[model samples]
Target: MAAYVGRGVHGQTVRLLGTRVLAGELREGDTIDLGALSTELDLSLTAIREAIKVLAAKGLVDSRQKKGTFVRPRAQWNLLDPDVVSWQVAAGAADTFFRDLAELRAAIEPAAARLAAQRRTDEDVVVLRAAIDRIAASVRGTAEEETAADLAWHRAMLAATHNEMFTRTDVFFAAGLSERDRLVHGAVHDDPVPSHSAVTEAVAAGDPGAAEAAMRALLDKAETDLRRATAMNRRAHDDHERGSTA
Candidate 1:
């Protein structure tokens, strides 16, 4: 159901795949074939047209006469667009697209964490600590409460990193972070307090390495849980396919 939700346009599926595509390197003025993509995704030309138009709004695809739609340079893509990220997430032909994103998070968040630790001010520490405490408080609160606090904590981390690029992207990350936990992390069964607190303490203490490692630990645990869920889903999908064929 989840995988299919990201299906292609024009009778194809819609997905909420996020992050991986926009982060890539794009050259200046790359031409793309709407016709080809339509055939590949088994969507109609109309569907492809509408989809590309949306991409164009995001500065991802530019359409001109005597030439079909073309991919804009990487700098132009609207990384913050929720639909764009979801589409990117759905565009993958292999399961690895998501796994790679998870793995990439594991690699990058740590470095970002380290930076935040070294650069964070006292106020930043207070904000992050407060967010962490809120997560703890919310654990016993309603589902919506926990979700909001968790995202707040993540945004604080992104801000503490003090990287404009990282900070700017927080809305996107915060929107998808918990969903990633739910889909990839087996419903976030493990408590997030311990996971997030380590990050806060390290940053508060100005321990760059520890901050990075702590952030990595949280993501690594997520990756582990995500892998489990993905494997389980794949096996179930394969069995379904086999049974249908049989």
Candidate 2:
């Protein structure tokens, strides 16, 4: 399973098949043929099964005793799964995925910030400050570095809450948050350091209301940036399609 896990034939099959389902090449209720996939991909049946298991865990497919494996409805999909989030982005669902992620953040982060302000330990503050410093350092660096730092900063914020449920969802937030950071960074020219710093200061001050307000403002700005970025992407896609036909 480890050998078949990443960038290998098994993993590639998982991504290809996941992308197809996400892109609507395979719609809900559509069944897949194991034998056909094996022959077409020139992969062993065991490898194919391993790939399917990965997809299944993401709520993309279900297998019955004799019914084979079928794509699940969109409502059944676990969008919070990092792998699913990554597949959605890969399948050109960035606008929808990011919008949903922004909504989730709006609902969760403010509360988390408030809780962190109330419950944060000295260690939490230290880690949060370090993560913020990392973000500041990456402002003039590569997008990848900035994205990594941004994710770490948010993860640290969640950890500061001292709530297992909030911290446990960190993995689910990983890909979506990283993708959101990438899009917002590419679209907006504003320096986000001050906004982030505000949250840090509020939390460090043990001011719940102020921390919550700062976090809300940060999320609000992100949503605004995401809307502008999505609109630009839509226009570009339309123009490209028109050019292709012309």
Candidate number of the best lDDT = 2
**Least lDDT summed over 10 consecutive residues: which range in candidate 2?**
1-10
Error of 1 at 55 (Å): 3.0
Please give, for residues 75-105, the per-residue lDDT of candidate 1 as tens digits: 7777446555455544442254455566656
Output the worst ten-in-a-row residue range by lDDT, candidate 1: 11-20
Per TM-score, the best of the predicted structures is: 2
Which stretches in model 2 have alpha-carbon errors above 4 Å? 1-5, 8-12, 35-50, 73-76, 90-93
Q: Residue-wise lDDT of candidate 2 within 172-201, one digit each (tens)?
A: 567787777776676666787888889998
Task: Quote the lDDT for 27 in model 2.
Answer: 95
Q: Candidate 2's error at 54, in angstroms?
A: 3.1
How does each model score on TM-score?
0.61, 0.81
For model 2, which pairs clash? none
